[model samples]
Target chain A: MKYCENCRVSVRTGRETCPLCQAPLKGESEHLFPEIKSVYNQFILFFKILLTATISGAIASVAINLMLPESGLWCHYVVLGVICFWILLITAIRRRTSIPRGIVNQVFWICVFSGIWDALTAWHSWSIDFVIPCTCMIAILALGVLGKVLHLPPSDYLGCILADAVFGIVPLIFYLTGVSQFVYLSLSCVAVSIIALVTIFTFHGKQIRSDLARRFHV
Target chain B: MNQIRTKWNKLDNAAKLFPTASTRAETHVFRFSCELTEPIEPERLQAALDETARCFPTFGYVLRRGVFWYYLEESRLHPEVMPEQRPLCARLYRPRAKTLLYAVSYYGCTINLEVYHVLTDGTGAMHFLRTLVMKYLARAYDIPEENLGYETAHTSMADDSFRRYSHRAPIKRTERPNAYQLRGAKLSESRTGLIRGTMSSRALLDAAHEKKVTLTAYLSACIIAAIGEDMPLRARKKPVVLDIPVNLRNYFASDSVRNFFTPIYVSYDFSRRDGTLDDILAVVTETFARELDRDKLAEHFCAFLALEENPIARITPLHLKDIVMRTVYHNTIKGYSATLSNIGIVRMPAAFAPYIRSFHVCNATNKLQACVCSFGDRLSISVTSCFTDTAVQRRLFRRLRELDSDLVIETNLLDDDA
Candidate 1:
């Protein structure tokens, strides 16, 4: 009912100007499409503030270390620590949709970072002896419990459990190579891994095989 | 261990590129909507959608990532009918999530069906929207249900027609020069801007008959002329190419509701010839004659299928294949200036036609795209573009206005100075 003299076409919108030529329309109008509001993320400001605060903290630590040389080059560690924090935060945020995948990812990253941190501090081997084995064992148990409680499909959590079991076997290599000074935790981790693998293979063999076949199809 | 195994399907040959190349800016989601004379009743629409979903079981599948290729796995997610709240053609497939690839929403009198390209193409989506409208009308008005004949069998509806029609032949590759590209500031948040013009189909068909060309060819020529008017003198060396997608079901026997279309390029150099509507139409008509041949189109599609069938390409890991496919998609798009898809006529039963106003089709695109679909005498041509500049749209509509003075336009854009 609204006609634009410039474009010579009738428009069915409630706007004053023509959509094509921006000329004033000449009649009454009716709505054809609903007006959609722009999407705004409120957490954007929170993330911006967090990023600024971390960068300033790293800078301030470096400045303080330079002023006091006796601090013995500790500022580089602060910078690396900030970078490590971001890596972990990003990984968690990216995998937040899938709980099983997130747990598996967190276990891998936490063990790797703890090993590096322990090496930097000293050759205590606490990361290999305690952190790696304990994290792997806890992840395997948590996945099993959650799968049962949540009633997730066998295809969903079975693969994560298998992955964690494989990770659980890593401490065996550490125990054999003498990288782990205390042997009890690593041996227990190995025992738990073998038991979990046996249980899954005994019961959910078909599900795992189909899942693996589809995933690794090439 | 009493679990029923979920069925999964390999991505069709044309579907492989969409999962890799689709971005937030270009979601590769297309929409088909039916506007009834009466305001949509949500409960009846929901009931209708449930029945339609039961008919097309493939629409219930979700996109999943595999090591070698992305596949569609059957899921139990039920689609609900809600008021339209998101921007037009918003992103439907998110990475690492389990969700259906299509959505149904309503606004005022219109029932909108938005589908990701990986699920099906325009023809399939049109069939779905028609069925939903019919079912809703049948329930609401107490009209006897009439069968809108389509392949309702599960096996045939889910068939992979690309693999079925492709005969193993030597692949032919032709080098194409890059076409002219549109440049302008894009809409914020990567939203698509749609300007649809509805007019009498009989008038346009008469004009095409007078010109001795098909309606699609005539419209392509008009679009080429419009783009040519805006081209700078320096960019005249690059030809303006229009990529037209041909529905393979027309040339071959198929009952699939999945993707089975291939694009054929029609490029016209304004510098080489006088830039007029007639000149452009002559070029487009000739190109259509050569490209629309059965053997030529078969060769064209088979060449593409041969790449997917290659031993090395089949064995390559999906992550690496994603990188290569994404690169190829970007490069291939650069060879075309724009896309014009004519979904042809949409038919509904006579009993339901009294409740329907018209049907429209459009898609999200990084560049400009025009989608045409007709219902009754109403022909809806929806032009969608990411760029803020509307000169090409302005010229295209002005040209169309000359053919019919009863043109009616509608847009989703807001007034800036208001």
Candidate 2:
């Protein structure tokens, strides 16, 4: 073991440089063990670079917009867009372990972002009438097909499918509140959600109920 | 092929609290590591693990919560041996993620075995680690396997001693005021900071002999004194209690690998007397003398068994039980300031002794804990704390350094200045 005088800590792995201060370590003691390298270090470096690029882009755009008056607060949108991109990307990365869950999450977020963007751009109803219902229908179909084809144990994807189905049924609220004038997509979404829920309850009812209980366990 | 029926066993009394009390921060996981003279060969170690896993059948089971209680069911999942990349004693038994209750990993020359406390205690884990090391050395050096001389019977290793000894009358429980608590900013993500000191066992033993006390008693006194030095005067109104886990295998004639131990607390209040190491040792020595009896220990466990035997506790759903258990656990932890578990000396067959360096045991805790064990002339005292401050560790080690001037310290803290 070598003690790093600069950092005032002992280094058991005998590294050439202090892990904290990056200064060359001084003084030696009995070597107890070898140094271990973590796998997360590379991912951390990648995230650092990504953060620097995003921050630099935002800062530069703000400076450029301030210099040019005609841009008219577009930099705020740019900054928000970058933040949303990172949020969506990080969620996708975290849920990447489960394909069914990952797809469901992506579909949910895409629907949400689309609705927000549509409402901001003068509410043409494209989000609720088309984007949300279309996305929900595709998610329901994908989840329904993948649940079987993936050969996953029921405990693995049942909660995810049930959650997506519950989200899918939200379109019925739009129909009930008369917010959605075009009823074709909304009705289809409701129909698909109901069919999916019924199938899950019929074929894998016990497993789904037990899975929900485990997930909701406090 | 004939279909075989798998058997499940109920967790012992002491293990009942772990499944419900465990959280992301305190998973009740402890690790035992054996450092060899050279780097480990993964394939050879894996082969040894396969054989050792068969020897300790109860250790390979997964934990499952039943409608009324948590039980262990035999798992067919092959233990996956990997490299030690995670932090020390990271959460091992997360729900649905690799169902094995224990994990085996190696980093450089150290073979690390991290076991969930629900599976076994330090005594049981030590047996498994020793057997694994012996088998690995035997295979690597072409030594005879039988020379290891270990009992491989499944019954002997899986016997529930707690059940066998719980036939006594239950004692009434008494409530005591909370002990003095150690407060500090914890490390990020509940990571435990480890600071281990390596010293000569002969030197430490000689010092303990000079004090006319056992090494454990001496260390316990030192720990109490160290805590007393830093505790505020107002905080000293409550006693500073040290929770020491006693291995019942020494008193009982059982070879069970499941959890079978009880904690005996030794508390000392600074306000009541002038703080001195000798005064602290007298209290600890007297506490051990009174509480170390067979009947007294058994009665302590019987009270625990009485709780499990209550009809309402038995019939409640596991989720509801979890809420109650968590509350009980929070209050239970508040009763102690710190925990000190002395695993004592680790002995091995002579043939494999030269290949191993030392053995270390550390438990995950939100409070400060010190695990003391010895091998040959090397006495390894590992201090694991969730707090970022090393004040307690510094005082303890500096006190020991007065005896052995050549004490070597190894720590995982990012900086050494504290």
Best by lDDT: 1
Task: For candidate 1, write residues B1-418 as lDDT tens digits.
Answer: 4474667888898998999999999999999999999999999999999999999999999888888888888887899998999999999998878889999999999999999999999878988998899999999899888878787788999999988988887867778999999998888889999999999999999999999999999999989999999799999999999999999999999999999999999999988999999999999999999999888888888998888888898889998999999999998999999999999999999998999999999999999999999999999999999988889999999988988999999998877622
Per-residue accuracy of model 2 over B1-418 as CA lDDT, tens digit each: 1122345678888999998888767879998999899889999999999988988888878776556777776766788789877777878876534378899999878899999999999989998999899999999998765543445578977888998888756546668679999998887767777778777899989988988888999999999998889798789899999999999988887778889899999989999977899889889889989999999899898899888888778778887898999898898888999999999999988788899999998889989899999999989899989887778887887787777766766766554323
Interface RMSD of 2: 7.4
CAPRI quality level assigned to candidate 1 from its DockQ score:
medium
| DockQ of all candidate complexes | 0.64, 0.09
Task: Provide the clashing-pair count of each candidate structure.
Answer: 0, 4
Over 4 Å off, model 2: A3-25, A29-218, B1-4, B96-98, B146-150, B416-418
Clashing pairs in 2: A1-A30, A1-A31, A8-B416, A9-B416
**Where's the lowest-lDDT run of ten residues in candidate 1 chain B?**
B1-10
Quote model 1's TM-score. 0.97
**Chain A: TM-score in each candidate?**
0.95, 0.76
* iRMS (Å) per candidate: 1.9, 7.4
